[model samples]
Target: MNLEETYRSLGLSDAEYARVRELLGRTPNFLELSLFSVMWSEHCGYKNSRPLLGRFPSEGGRVLQGPGENAGVVEVGEGWALAFKVESHNHPSAVEPYQGAATGVGGIIRDILAMGARPVAVLDSLRFGDPADGRVRYLFREVVRGIGGYGNPVGVPTVGGEVEFAPAYTGNPLVNAMCVGLLRVEDLMRSRAVGVGNRVILLGARTGRDGIHGATFASDELSGESEARRPNVQVGDPFAGKVLIEACLELRRRDLLVALQDLGAAGITSSASEMAAKGGVGIEIETDRVPLREGGMEPWEVMISESQERMLAVVEPERVEEVLKVAARYGLGAAVVGRVADHGELRVLCGGEVAGSVPAEYLADAPAYEREVVEPEYLKEAQRLDVEEIPVPGDFNAVLLRMLSHPNLCSRRSVWEQYDYQVRTNTVVGPGADAAVMRIKGTKLGYAVVTDGRGKWCYLDPEGGGAATVAEAYRNLSCVGAEPVALTNCLNFGSPEKPAVYYQLARSIEGMSRACEALGTPVVSGNVSLYNETSGGAVYPTPVVGMVGVLEDVSCHATPGFGREGDVVAVVGASGRASLAGSEYLEIVHGRVAGRPPEPDLALEKECADRVRRLIAEGLVDTAHDISSGGLAVALAEMAIAGGVGVEVEVGSGRRPDVELFGEAGGQILIAVPGERWDEVREALAGVPWQIIGRTGGGGLKIGGFVDLKLEELRGAYGRDLFAEETG
Candidate 1:
């Protein structure tokens, strides 16, 4: 290929090329062009979503480190802190499911480790297309296997996460990974290389040609020929990853490093340039000094290869020997590949020759586009569902059975069974719960975390859907008796150049930010994965929120299952106000994906959630779960199925039975209290709209005297296997 083709193939526009030339004030070499190509791409530069992301509330009392870091850190309690973040590997997962997902998990772990914390737990949120399709089924299996393959061996507990299936993800699946780590507040690390003349170390894995142009590749749309892009997906080594985690944490413990950064996306170019920019200094990297796994790799190849299981850090010249000694003891590759310089320019050297040089600040700051978002005509139509015209099911019992067995609502036991969730023994409540609660070992304090999003809702109403996403996560944490603190997110959208996609992007951010401000759960760190479009169309805007809540005492949290037969069941807040818009029942029974999702009342949401947390803290509630998705009826059935018992509940007092029974309105919670504390339940929920539905009991589910089904039948439908049905 010629020079122009080479640069264009890297996803850089001609205008951007001209800007690079202007910055350098001269014609550029291939090395300089490669550097700018990946550094300025959407993956590294966040050229499209950066301005929109600024709308999120990113400040709170617990946030120690916010955006621009490898991961965000929040103080938990008693001199301990938690570092967490969520990142997406969507395009790669669609192209090469196994390696793409494995490396995604590996990448997020390194991010947590870079903050000088011991990696503790992992959670993932996945979205796939119609499960009945053979290709989508294959992708689902391989992706889950890949997640378990890497996480199980790394000794990090693969706890709880959510998976949903929809047609919007037919050819472009999203695999977003989240990792949580524990660290003493004093041991927190930063990526700012403060001192000039400090030596930069390349630790762990070696550079190769495996994942060249990965950042540019990820920033584009997929097609039927996406398989041809498989080589752009990096391979992962879980064993090497586990060792690197240990080696890096050991380095931090010994205070042998001044700064650390994980080598991901654009690899060396992004890591070095970003560190230099953040530190307000310069970095000079020698490609000849970099350890390589392949022969005859070009200078640009070494600079941009997205090799897996690697870290970049800087240390004082006098402490370099100790760092090298730690690397040697761990049986890993390490080399002094660069040095901090006072020139304020990122200079590339190879075999004592200059290959490229650019101002670090200019390289890190890409031009942000201010796109005008025009609401789509299709969205206006989609939001115009006439609820009164839609037919309600004749048999509520049969409808409940169908909703339970639907692919979107079935049990995920087969998926979570593949993961090793009991590793490290910190997990108090793992999968099959509202949130995964992990203890702080010797102390009574703990933390709860969950990943949640509803793309179908976002497709209907971006603003309301976005706000509801944050609100649902907040309520989910509160159900488990944890106080919501901060969150990390993965905003997956389509091409922002498209007016409709930009509208979804902007409105979703605006909505979620407002919710964050209301709930006081600020965004700390996040990732934006765009261009999730195939020839079919853009995927639904999926803004997955990874929220963390703090627990004052680990031993005192509520599970989402009935513990006693005599427990009294009650619905709190606005249960009667539940509506069927953007609900699973609407799609499954009526075959429509229309209508606005429930608009969350942020003020009322926080008040109700706080009361629920108080109930759990005071030992007045036995079980708690939020009403979402399938709404009141499905929530009751799930609690019964989880506890292996039957429940008889009287619901749907005066409203339409179907909407009251299955509507997915926000700000409502279901809690079961001991029979004797019914008075206390009434007293605690005095200010909110609440009602005592019924009492938990016998061998069947009796809902509002209309829907009645055997517990055996309910469990059977809930556990029905979609894969089995598809294959049969």
Candidate 2:
């Protein structure tokens, strides 16, 4: 059975069935329906997305928990863990970008806090249509400001992430916010509303019309006009979020709560049902007892409302008052809204009337649906074309600058700068660096993280794209002087019913496995989102990859930004004529996107990365950055801006702009070595594809074969025009 049929038998009324049926001709089968519930659910599904989410990496070890739970977890060790997860607010964002994206961040943070961890960082991955689209441009501007507004005030470092523009997302853009927290293994909190007689407390914001029926709202497609969905998009107050984090962590420290869950998505309904089911217990919620910001809400409205900055806690009966005191300390609302029962039913009552009841197990454990696999006809279409036969640009420099200035390749500094990346102060290497690095307080160790995805490439060649995504993440860590230890991923794809989607997923998985095996990086946690399809079409296959590496010395890491004038710039690894078939540069200039990205020779990549690490440690390299995305030109410009210096380089090839500058090449590093140590650095990296592209000088970026532009101009190209002229 497929996804459509399962809903048909759900005993829906003709109208409701027709609505579900008419949403499209397809009805998932029983199993597909179950899987659909899990995958499409606010917890599992990307329904509003049934489009646009095909851009994330969903595999790797340092991962403690992959998708499919309250949150995803990665190993952060000495017997510690970091739980993190990224979820979309497309529908909500469409309704209210500020509150939508803010609460999205707040919600993910609570997921970590509930796991008995202290959130240390937040990352948001965003997408919008071409800024030329007024509505999208407005939404994009507001969303960025909103995410920054919330994350900044709350003190969680908004580290590394990306922004992209594509017409496919015009109608319903995606905003995925991820939060990661630190915890000792022994302190991990589990959500199980166990222990009969435990009081269910609602703390944080008072319930209101805000975010009512968010789950049901999310379980549908966004038709662009989201007036009706406005109430379902929760309002956020990061100040309130900050207090809640402190209160909860304090409560946990005092052992005042038995179990806890964030009131997100389905709000009380989901938290209660899931917690009850997880603990093999039942819950009886009294709606009248729920504190409300406004009066006269219906029982269901109170039960399912997703008001932001709130949490549901199953407190030890004896410690309820103690936990209440913590909320009081934070000046937050606190109320006993329900109680845990030995019976396994999730019951709700209001004004002495039984409003509704259901088996906790049914609500919590939505059936997991396995999908039917069908291959798309496109793979065969792609296979028939000879990659070498594609047209090559006569001038690579023009292509390099075009790609460097492409919205996707441009500097994300504009977006990240608005965010207070240095807020927590633990941030050792903030945004604009290869990976975001943070120091472990009181410890000599440091952590490095980065998120990478190439949706178009993944769409064109899943295996290569997936492998490259992982390799790119590892390379990012290495460039920052950290050794990648583990990985976590979020797999975003479209309807899996089509063999083509399944093929993309399977091939990508193969790529991940092969790359991990070669690099010795293990998969620790992950999440998979499917059914991201819309009436228009499915989103490009996207696998967002998140990686974490460790560095013994926090001070030794490197960033892509320019360091100092007169510093020698050297390119490590072989320079090849990159195939521009599916290049972002090609797409921006030539109006086409297809073909494979540059493939990494794993053996060669490992050797080169190790040598760079050694050189950094030997103090021979002043600064280093990885060559990726927009290739050497972008890399050079980034280094120049970061160091607040200028550079001049000359490649051996007469064709300066060729693959060396614009290609999405991997396993390449640009190092800034002191002129005095240039000889030593060259000798240290002997036998590698290393070359002196140029030296830092002139206070502007000068790519011999490309247009010369001031460092400020190059930075402006990446930051200013990437968005539409008006918006910028």
Candidate 3:
């Protein structure tokens, strides 16, 4: 191929080529060009997002390891550390749902394992188009199946997650996976290749042509011609993933590995180069030495192919044989592909000939671009809707039932049942709660995790939606009596090349940053998935926040259920006032996704969350649930359903009945306290905003004179099989 053709095939612009030549002081060879292409691609380089991501606060007292590692690690007390992260597989999932979603799980599990932690649980945050469309239904079904298929065999419980549907995702669906693991703080591992003579070992699976240029592929937008990119999607093997996890932990136990890294996105090129650059050392890899699934593969393909279930480790030269034995016992491929060098250049040898050599820093650090941001014109139209224009239901009882039955508000039992959530016996609280709580074996400490997002809210007002998303996750953790510690996010946005999309990205990050500061939760690790637009259109700027909090005593945790018949139900922090703008009621009932979302008051949010957490920890409250989406009515309904009981509440009728019952406001929580402890609970919550609104004993839910329904009636509407119509 001619020089220009070669450059284009490598996904490099003429300007980038010139930069590479100037840096190298000479023309680069074929292998060097290929390495530069994958490493500098938007997926690996964070070219468009690096500057924005810097806005996040990434340090805290409890943080042991922050963003520059495989995963963020936080001290969880009792000599244990938690490692966790969330990443996106959007592009691949849209093209090939099953394999794409499956590998996303496999990839994240390895990330935790690389830190010498035993992965305990996996959660997912998914988005799809209107389920009424045949293609959207198919994509949704396969993505869920793929997540369960991979996670179940790997032995990690699929605990809890969130899913949303919207028209923006009709052509580009999103599948983001998060994994959490535990390990002794002393056993934590780093990804730097520190020792100059350490052996570079490639473990698990053979290299293949599949997923070639996957990083570059992810950096581009999807068009009608994206079908041809199917080969770039990596196929996953969960059984292999299981075995690899076991072998890696065993290796760590034996103290055999000096450093390790998971082979994701850019495959060997990224792993090997990042390891070298981080340690200020060099690496030499023989392309021919890499185990290949297919013969006659070119050197560049072997270097960049993102084969699944693979890891690269820096092993002590003396203990290489022992490490190989452990890998062999697990039936994994272990090959000594190279060694760390004192020289600071990455050298590639093809068929015993030096094919390429370049400075490791040049490949690892891609140049960042500050894209221009212009306010989206559609925002003006989206913000113009008046809540008064939308009609409120005349019969409040029927409206509550309809809202409960809506797909977005309905129970997800059908989906969670397919997961092996009870496995490993460490799950203290599994799916169906505000957050999944898992006990650390042999300790009183536990960790709580929750994944949340609001796509329609974000689409209408990116800033408020972004702040609200973080606040929601924080409140969920607080409801469970856990102190918010740190967070990992997966930011999915449209192409950055468009000024309008860039504005959303910038404003959302600003909002998240502000909320994180107000809530005192640092962002330790995250992934950015850009170019999530197709010919159909761009998706709502969806930012999925996965938060981790620590519970000092596992026994003190709370659930969203009425604990006793005579318990008094109270609304804490703020009353639920209906703001119909960008609400589910407006979207599902009126067929429009417009208007400003509820304004998030960060100070009030923090005060309310702190009050709720204190009440639970002090054992003054029996049940706690946050008010979101469908508002106070829905929160009360969910608490009753989980407890299999009923409640009698009185709405003050001081405002519109609908606003009092269904306003989508933040900074409010529903709490249940024993009748005997009413005085004590009230005193402890003094100086905090709260109102005793109801009692938990009854056979039917009574909302004053507005609505009353049997407990079973509420359950029947909320618990119906969600996908039964389509599946049958």
User: In TM-score terms, which candidate is top?
Assistant: 1
RMSD of each: 1.2, 5.5, 1.5
Q: Write the per-residue lDDT of candidate 1 for residues 1-728, one digit (tens) a residue.
A: 98789779878898898888888898788888888889899998999999888899899999999998999999999999999999999988998898889999999999999999999999999999988899999999899999999999989998989999988999899999999999999999988876999999999988988789899889999987778988899999999998899999999999999999999999999999999999999999999999999899888899999999999999999999999999999998899999999998889999899888988898899978879899977988888878888876789999999899987888888889999999989999999888999999999999999999989898899999999999999999999999999999999999999999999999999999999999999999999999999999999999999999999988889999877797888877865567778989888888888887779999999999999998998888759999888988999999988887678887646877788787898898889888888897788888877878888888778987669999899988999765566621
Deviation of model 2 at 727, angstroms: 9.4
How many clashing pairs does model 2 include? Answer: 59
lDDT of all predictions: 0.90, 0.72, 0.90
Candidate 1 weakest lDDT stretch, 10 residues = 719-728
For 1-728, candidate 2 gives per-residue lDDT tens digits of 43335454332234444443344355523322222232236443332222322333445656555544566666665776767666666667876888788887888888889888999988777777777778888899889888888888988989888787776667667777777788877777878788899899998988887876566555455654456668768889999999999998888888888888998877787788888888899999998998888988877677767788888998878888888877897898899988999889778877777666666775654333344556677765653435355465776545555566667777776677788887768988888778888888877778888877767777878888888888888888888888887666666666565677877877777787677778877665455555455666666777777777777777777777666678888888777745564666556765666566666778788888888877876667648888776667777877777778888998657442545466666888888888888888888888878877778888677766554777666666666544446432
Cα-based TM-score, every candidate:
0.99, 0.85, 0.98
lDDT of 3: 0.90
Q: Over 4 Å off in model 3, which ranges?
A: 726-728
Candidate 2 residue 511 Cα shift, in angstroms, is 3.2
Measured by TM-score, how close is model 3 to the native structure?
0.98
